[model samples]
Target: MDRLGDTYRWKSENVSTAEVAETLGHFSGIHEANVYGVQVPGHEGRAGCAALSLDDGARKDFDWKGLAAFAYQKLPRYAVPVFVRVLGTEVGSAASHNNKQDKVKFGAEGIDPGMKGKKVVGGEGDEVWWIPPKGIGM
Candidate 1:
């Protein structure tokens, strides 16, 4: 099989997938979650941004700015989750744990601007902003 070469060279510079996932899980209030890298302007690492999918099925995408804000508020810079991409569909959990609906799958794109305040599965109650953090300068 062809080697799965590192598609994101920038990711090597900083931040690990484990760290990203852990941070997102702690902040998003979800047990199962996945964090992936996203490319952004001016950022050194492609993984500078992380897209997190939670276990409860509530997804929210946060950028560096947003992550930093969360970090400042509760977590440290290292624990700050950047570039979150919320998912609309449910994500599965690890084998040891029950297969719960992953909410972090809902990225910024999945959320509709009109439904920002509306309650969605795996998301906050109605009236909460669903807009991606990056869209609003994080």
Candidate 2:
């Protein structure tokens, strides 16, 4: 098993979680982002997943496609997140001391379409969105 750390391999390319998170932070409605790799069945490397906290005014009608476009524009093809977890404004377990983000829990909860939304994000209003292989334009 590969150790989870500063970078992870996906689609034969090394992906930097910090870099992806920074790219996501630049998007208009995203207030916070936590990027990490999660295991995918039958895949050789982990897939990127981003957990997001939105701005107060942007939650209801947040532009998902716009964010996707931003990510595609700013990051390499391999680094674009395959799964997006919406945490609303609730910090929950995504952060800890000194406001540093933690990716363990989120990483464990891979983008399983079978899992209920609230169970993975820990909030009734939270959501999990994912793009299947070749599903999205990315």
Candidate 3:
């Protein structure tokens, strides 16, 4: 049996990072996607967030709304990532020594723009992008 703790809960629903990552991976613009649970101030539980690496030149044309819509359609409401971070050119920067995606740093960073300058193991000077909760702008 699967334990709830193994899967983080958001809005009273269990969220599987691997499942979300797999769904996000289907998008052509996303070269790589890393999913994790992130603490949101005043929220009952951690919110879902995705760290994405865009394909070459895709940033110029990346569609945030489309991605949001896709996520909404493919995942449960609670599983849809509440935030997204766009990485810089070096996409593998967030990977572990074995090339596996690492979420510890990202989870700690949350969605604060103030955390921008902080450095991750292999991710120095990487850019981060996210949609504010208001959904008015990116």
Pick by lDDT: which candidate is best? Answer: 2
True-structure lDDT of candidate 2: 0.76
- TM-score, candidate 3, is 0.81
TM-scores for all candidates? 0.41, 0.80, 0.81
Alpha-carbon deviation at 64 in model 3, angstroms? 1.5
Candidate 3, residues 1-138: lDDT per residue as tens digits?
Answer: 753223567998888888998999998799988888888889898888888988999989988778877787788777888888877744466666777676777777777777754646434445555544434552
Please identify which of the two predictions, 1 or 2, would achieve the higher lDDT against the true structure: 2
lDDT of 3: 0.75
lDDT of 1 by residue, 1-138 (tens): 311211233534544555556555576445444543444457564433343344542334434355455644653343344444444433342111344322223322233345432333444432222223333555
Provide the lDDT at 111 for model 1: 33
Candidate 3, residue 5: how far the Cα is off, in Å: 10
What does the lDDT read for residue 56 in candidate 1?
49
Off by over 4 Å in 1: 1-13, 54-70, 73-79, 93-138
Q: TM-score order of candidates, best first?
A: 3, 2, 1
Write candidate 2's Cα lDDT for 21-58 as tens digits. Answer: 98899999888888889888998999898889888879
The CA lDDT at 47 in model 3 is 86
